[model samples]
Target chain A: MNGAEKIRVENLTKFFINGKTAVSALENVNLTVNDGEFLCVVGPSGCGKTTMLRILAGLEKPTSGRVHINAKAAGVPSTAVVFQGDSIFPWMRVVENVEYGLKLRGVPLKERRAVAMEHLKKMGLERFAYLYPYQLSGGMKQRVNVARAFACDPEILLMDEPFGALDEQNRLLLQQELLRIWEENCKTTVFITHSIDEALLLGDKILVMTAQPGKVKALLDVKIPRPRDIILIKSSPVFIELYKEIWDLLKEEVLKARNIK
Target chain B: MNTTEERLSQNRASLGKEFWLKTFSFLSPLFLLFLWEALAALKLVDVRLFSSPSRIFKTLIPLVLSGELIYHTLISTMRIALGFLAGAIPGVALGLSMGLFPSVRALLMPLVAVTFPIPKLAIMPLILIVFGLGESSKIFTIAIGVFYLVLINTMAGVLNIDPIYIDVAKSFKASRIQFYTTVAFPGALPMIFAGLKLGMGTALLLIVAAELSAAKAGVGWMIWRAYDMFDIERMFCSLIVLAFLGFVFSYLLDFLEKIVIPWKKR
Candidate 1:
């Protein structure tokens, strides 16, 4: 772990519905996200990947063990979340939504609007600053979500399938845009995705989790060089090997979940 | 982009229709006024019983200028405003608490369901006996009528809130107060406004009913006085004031809703 560990999860366990019909969501899951690392969590459905992300975000309490931020306590640090559903406040305009956390922290209008406009410009949404969430497309809304999270200048960003709802073309475009933003910001990020392709595209280190009682089955470090392009990365031999390994790990869980003969 | 452009054009046409609809809405009332004047001019009906618009306006101008209209309207407005606040605040608070907590809901739901059907104004005679035939009795009657409607709306609003929003707020680690103020309160605004608008109308209607029963100074009092003396022209003037007053109060509430909830804008 050395000096790289930004977040250290030590034997984190979470169980749902109490002891009555206790189903363990995460069992003694241990992981570390290094500083400036874009980590992706990929796993099958019902694998408790979201549960893990929620625990890290301090949205859910772990039944046992601990989650630490830089070896400090972990209970909702100045971390921002980009939920799958955009989570942009419907009532606020694009700029207002982007400035919400800043406003909550008592940033004045002149300063917050400037900061919000800066972020919106980066997200390519500067034109629609006055538009409401409902007025924007699925792709544009996600851009606002990204811009909002980053505008807070949070210690870490936790995104839970932010592009999962978009069409393939929008999703791909957004994935590239996210990579560009992540490269520029270089904030410690924990992105959750079900797609192996997405995990490969964004993550420096991918934590492949298993189903039922979810546990980090493997941590596959992507060997691809920086400034990676999606098209080129897909053609690379390293991408294929890592993708295959993660696919096999996921295949077992898929079969087990379906009770396949 | 193509889909949105199509939708934008469709919405533009609908907006054009909305403008025409608004124009027609204003014009329909004027058309009705013209019809009424025409009937009276042609001597189609007893002009004394149902006075013409011009006759009513002529009578209203003097009453309004002499400060009688302002005095009566002010008195009625003040009473209704006081009663509305007294009833609505507590009613919404109680309704919200009941709607949010099941234990409270279980205990009070039966009580509310039972008593809701009973006419609130029917207790006016009882209220008159208890509070006396003064401003207290009239205000109490108005408050009670408003309370029933406001309380029900408050409860329904809270009940009908999408649970997804609560879950979203919770998942964001929002504090209890933050959750209530940011999520629940705003979430319930549309419905609460619905109730408030209804309650305002109810309170205004009940004020007239209360004053008609017994009062010395109010629009309703003027109404009752005019009816008793068979002062047709003055009575028509009073009725016009009542209609205008109702319109103004409701329009004020609508204006407030627009400012507070600009999100509801299409």
Candidate 2:
């Protein structure tokens, strides 16, 4: 399991019909992420970055080609997704929402609660154990969202711009928190973000993607060491180089995305 | 513009408003009862036609001690419970199926439209003719009356469940049973309970009308028998029993709603 290729997408294409006209969303997109690797996918808005993430999570289907996990079909999933919004069930309290997957799996109540509480503690949300999603702050809700995916102990975690909605300070804090958890868990994770600094700060490899009819434009591997600190990494030359290179690759796509094409 | 102490005092006043609102609600009925009693004592109103609270209370003790009130109340309750079970369970199941499948809706809509407008109680005479003047006829009429109300509410509830929730459940590979039980049932419960509460009231009314035709038991029968004997006090006592039963029914449903949907609780 340690050396296995966690996910493989081969020649994937997606088409959308807006009224009577058809538009290609992604074309001939192929990629693979190895086990325990943290890959960040960056692309212009509507570039199918989120679509690709949804595909990996089994929330959407490609118009053509195949997605495979460990040489098996990926139409269903052995993955869990942390959506862009908090997406916590308002009807469920913090601990109950976190334990949802476990509940579905028929994990016994006492044990499931213990495991849910453990994840909540990791997310610094034990104090809000019994609080409903509506009662939590935006940052706290996202924390619960992340904790929910992790609590399920999924082999592959798909995150679609999980911090895109947060304020800068909170985003940075959560980014560091994400890095800390990812380092400890070492699960295969594919994260979607528009933030170059975020990709640099957290990703072992960054996938830069182009706008509409999305294709992998560039893949940059970060040679940074593990247990990286946010303050230290921001100050490092290596981090700055990777950030600039990715930004340089992304600038044109960003322009095209904003309709300066 | 106000100081902290003034703000605190204002907050206290607002809290007092909610407390007073509840107090007013509880006291309003008692006040109405007091006024009625006063009017009767002063001979401002005919006491025989509009029985005062004291007279009604005096009438209630003997009816209870004689065990006649309890017997009538039990018979009425049993009929309602049986009728509700007969109607609502199948009605909801059928409604949900229709709601989820467009084809079912298309096929069933014509029949439902044709029959839904027809007052179910209007068929009571036909039911009585076929089933005879027994408990079965009354129960059957009550069931038919309640069924359509539950069906429409359940169908609407199922159709109106937040689509995003269904999408979420599907994305997680929820089994069909899981989808219905977790998503459909709980999502539709508030509406289903809404239907049931209305159905209970309708069933009670229909029970009285059914009893008026010819029946020997139930609160409705008791009321009609007392009317025939010109026992106004007994009639008032039966009406009081009916009111109490309706109150209890509504309160029980509300309590269950709060328990099941604790999300509504503060």
Q: In terms of DockQ, which candidate is strongest?
A: 2
**lDDT of residue A97 for candidate 1:** 79
lDDT of 2 by residue, A26-129 (tens): 99998989988899999888898888888887778889998997734434247888888747776788999898777777779999999999999988899999
Q: Candidate 1 iRMS, in Å?
A: 2.7
CAPRI category for model 1: acceptable
| lDDT score for candidate 2 against the true structure | 0.85
Stretches of model 1 off by over 4 angstroms after superposition: A1-3, A10-13, A18-24, A71-78, A102-117, A126-135, A258-261, B1-70, B89-118, B151-181, B226-237
Which ranges of candidate 2 are over 4 A from the true structure? A1-5, A71-77, A90-96, A102-117, A126-138, A166-170, A222-224, A235-261, B1-23, B37-61, B96-114, B155-160, B163-171, B223-235, B263-266
Lowest summed lDDT over 10 consecutive residues: which window, candidate 2 chain B? B164-173
RMSD list, candidates in order: 5.1, 4.0
Give a tens-digit lDDT track for model 2, residues B1-266: 89999999999999999999999999999999999999999999898788788888998998899998999999999988788778888888888888778899899878987998988768878998999988788888888878888888988988898875676576566788878877787778778888888888888888788887878899999889999898888999988888998899889878877888776445
iRMSD (1 decimal) for each model: 2.7, 2.3
Best candidate (score: lDDT): 2
| Per-residue C-alpha lDDT of model 1 across residues B51-87, encoded as one tens digit per residue | 8889888988999999998999999888898889888
What DockQ does each prediction reach against the true complex? 0.26, 0.31
